[model samples]
Target chain A: MDMSQYYGLFISEAREHVRKIGESAVQLEADPTDRPTIDALFRSAHSLKGMAASMSFTAIADLAHKMEDLMARIRNGLPVDSSLFDLLLAGADRIGAMIDDLESGGSGRGDSAALIARMLAYSPGEQPAPPDREVVETSPPSLVPPGEPVGTTAGEEWGVPKTVRVKTDTLDSFVTTTGELITVKHRLALLAGSCREGGLHEALRDLGRHLRALHDQVMAVRLLPLSAIAERLPRMVRDLSRQLGKEVSFTMQGVDMELDRSILDLLGEPLVHILRNCIDHGIEPPPARGAAGKPAVGRLSLSVARRKDQVEIEIADDGRGMDPGAICAAAVARGVISGEKAAGLTSHEKLMLVCQPGFSTAPAVTDVSGRGVGMDVVKHTLQSLGGSLAIRSEPGRGSTFLLKVPVTIAIINVLLVVVGGMTVAVPLTAVIRTLEIRRDERGNVDGEEIFFLDGEELPLLTLGGLLNIPGGDGPGDTLAVFVAEIGGRRVGIQVDRLLGHQEVFVKPLGRPLSALPGLNGAAILGDGQIVFILDIVHAG
Target chain B: MMFRLRERRFALEVDAVAEISELLPEYPIPGAPPFLRGVVNMHGRVAAVLDLGAFLGLGTAGRGGSLVLLESPGCSLALLVEHLERMITSDDVGATRRGESRLLPVELVLADGMAGLLDVAALMDAVEKSA
Candidate 1:
């Protein structure tokens, strides 16, 4: 096989491994006694070194090899103090930089002779005194037994040998075909209206079934188990903990849950930001944890699970939870939120205030946290991917961030409506409910138009008025109202008529019509007529 | 080389020509520049679509019938155009010295024609700043 074809894959995989090493190194520094974490870091380095060597990425190869040797010594019972962990972390950073250079088609070069010499100096010549017996007794059961052979020695018995390799172009083609299919389906739907016969109905039904099947198959092909991404995270936590002089134990579950590839890429950065925030702010120091009746080392866990058509990822920590009052004060001090509003907010709302841009509760900026860039970017990124982020916190019990994202972006279930003679589609997931109202029943409450539904008055806005479309009827004898929620606010949209539900491929509206507020994109329906899709948040 | 802004005509650099298509009205995005119509789907990717008439101080009072897609550093965008006149390459096209032409907030002049070159980078910066 031509090695050139593998360069992209190699670079991506190497970067992942380096990140894992950073995380694992952090965890090892936290405990300095978790042999399993140490072994994991060593394995990551070893694999990365081998891959880099094969790919002829000399800088990455050499640095990973040196780091692996150092880890080998530590794994052989040699005590690694904070300084040694720092050196390992520095090596991890170098590997990361080299990977970045490779990504940009630059030769990785720098002065690293001194660091390489330092790594070489650490030798596993003799084992140090065994860990105290009491420490061993209390260690987690998963840690390697004191005298177990390292590396391949303990894996043959239970290891599964399976590897399936598929060309990247194949996946790319699959995505493209799926996109085209959506367009064709929309065109067919438009044509169905022009045909008037039982034969036309039968043909339309057949086409619908075929399109639905194809849509599901395409989505499945794009879905990958979450473990492929989560596997490298533990290593990352370990390395980051070591570098920052903090102890953090990172764990993950629900690795079998699957998600769209695009979603995984969208999720990567926000998850990193959240993890860094946890280490920098959530995890308390050893002395602090001990004083608070918690373990000396802080614990962080990330779990992913499927809920209906969406995936839920939870990142939780067992450190000192956030104090909403402190956050509110910080927000006011930073001038991010007004003092008047801060005073009136509930605790849950206060906690969410941390996600506001430039709002940091930290007393002062540090190397890791308090840089004025908080969870706001995370929220924006998630929202752009059609997702939401929620925060839950208790005064002293750490914070948990839950991110909900859809499985795929290619095909969506939408509620079709008519405004100003043009067809529009709204993602069904974003719609709260739909109602019919009469003009006489539309009442003004608190200076806003409201409609009573289920004993509650819902605020309403005319879709035509919102989109600047003319010729819309007033809330008269019959009004169709579509209620949608975005960013925690619910708003009712009054449309001329409800066109029912559809599963359509949403094609982005071309350049000329891009500026219409609340319109995300357009789709060609079965009859070849283009229908605009609404951006719920912006519309609200 | 011919440029159409609302009803007025101006010359544009033929080399600057990329691709032109029909305009599709896009949703208004908060914090975007007044000139930015909104993002439009170009192929499968979302591309910011700019209103050339509004961008060049030529009042965006008339409906734009065409779109011109231009390339940027990391991405490309489409600009609404009313009419794309004949392309002209001429060595004698005179240069309007700095300060010779009124400095509109978002227009740049070139030799082939006075067609307003869409300043996408500036527009993006303005958007970011407002954001």
Candidate 2:
């Protein structure tokens, strides 16, 4: 069949159906008696068969035909087993490879006869093998992966951009260019301000409006709902926990929270690391849980919430919580810290030690996950995103890793501060409150500055002192204190001058430069003055 | 396209050149190595301005001058130059191959002096290695 024109439609729709079956299979495994999910899985398999038949992709159609038959019986209340999941997953993998082969201009064919026979062998109340599989069928796939719809053709009918398949790099460039334009607008604003020409001022104002709108649209394009990166967690948790011989009930909140695609992509690894750690180190085995008078099934939950422009992600595992005393001892033995220093360390600081690059108490997952790395990578990744990660654990309870991250990395609203003759941009969203501190409000604790903010005493650091930049209009009796949240703690950053706020585009500090401790990148002011954007997440 | 850093001259293909702007106010990044001369806002985009002299071990000589913005698919850098000397077509610049190296080692022989032409890909590798 000459089906050249329909390849794109067929490939996309077929892949969606393939995904539907895999995800539904996991759901059905979780609740074997879920009638709707079973029906949906069968429908997806059937849709795949019909689509493949229409494209004359006999190999795909044949495998789907058997899968559909198997699911249909399972839908009819037959007992399902893990072996069934294994077989279905294997079938889905093979079908995926076949479609990929076809997309790359090869015949959409694979040896599915073995797979077909295996499904037939496992089928309960086996009906006689049908003589003829349906062919030349073009009805759209009836089922979509849960939370998304792809049943009818009506979505394509609308003129609006239903779904755009833009390469990430394309969106990146668009964002970059928009950032450049915003910088230009700043320059124009400066020009207008200096000249004080009425016409130019109005023109500049109009330009600012346009640029702001453009920036919003560009940023919106970059923001992807968390579900894009999170959809497979349930399946992963189920598979990994089962493989580890542990019982876990995984739950997620705010799955629809959105973040920049770039940030979200980098986030996946850190999350995977934490989740694996939860199963291997944090979560107690079923016997241990029962011994502790706890539920046999371990509970691991992820909650994501947007706090202004920043998103906070919390991964909590109700398993074996960390022992701070043991951590301190380990740190001391590893020469990570002195015995005296370890004794002085706060509970939070001791927990943070687990994320120190070479710090690990639990043996690495050298077998299944093949990940020998620890929480340090997670901390580093968060730092790079102008974010911070903190861990909270109770000895007999569990551990929760909190990550506070900026929602968008491309553009930011910052409170620019000048310290030691250098201008630095602090993300405004990170700033909880800015205050004018009177001399009475400032005090010293352990020779370090402290401030009473909102009825709480918090440690304060001079921006200049932190950067080791000398000779800033040194701290005055009355100071401007910026309270920023980092790593689940509050810090007061006292700066020499408050340069007010701005919405600026940020670029990567790039490679070696990016390695610099607390600076994310640079932002240009209206007068073309470059200011380093501070990584308050790390600094605080 | 050609520009000079201190007394040394470097040449990049015209297409590699994104824009040229007079020195912008640079905020010194405290912990960065000497080769990286902080960052400058090129329009709204923040870019790391490289002191080629420092990278080549020539020592960071000039700070106030022009920036030659260069970008590839995944990388972008602002080459800090002492001056925007002049633009010469690839044909006009007498090029030479350093026979020993597989990578391009073209030197553009200008009227007054010779400017070493760099392979953008290799330069990117150098930057990545620098990280």
- Predicted model with the maximum DockQ: 2
Stretches off by above 4 angstroms in model 2 are: A1-13, A54-56, A76-79, A99-109, A124-181, A194-223, A335-341, A369-373, A439-441, A474-477, B1-27, B41-45, B62-73, B81-131
Q: Score the docking of each candidate (DockQ).
A: 0.21, 0.40
Per-residue lDDT of model 2, residues A1-540, tens digit only = 356876877788788787777777887777888888887877778778777876778889888877877776676556787767877877887899999999999998988887776676673345534434322223333333322333334344634456757667899999989988888888787767769568888888898899899888988988888877676677778778888889999888998999999999999888878888888888888999999988999999999998877899999999999998899899899988889988988898888988886787866535543455568888888888888888899987999988888889988889988777777898887788888888787889889878887799998888777776763435577887788865567888888888799988886765446656887777776778877788777762
TM-scores for chain A over all candidates: 0.74, 0.87
lDDT of every model, 2 decimals: 0.69, 0.77
What is residue A53's positional error in candidate 2, in angstroms?
3.9
Q: What share of the true interface contacts does candidate 1 keep?
A: 0.02
For each candidate in turn, give its C-alpha RMSD to the true structure in angstroms.
7.3, 5.1
How would you encode candidate 2's per-residue C-alpha lDDT over B74-103 as one tens digit per residue?
455788878776778766756564522322
- Among incorrect, acceptable, medium and high, the docking class of model 2 is acceptable
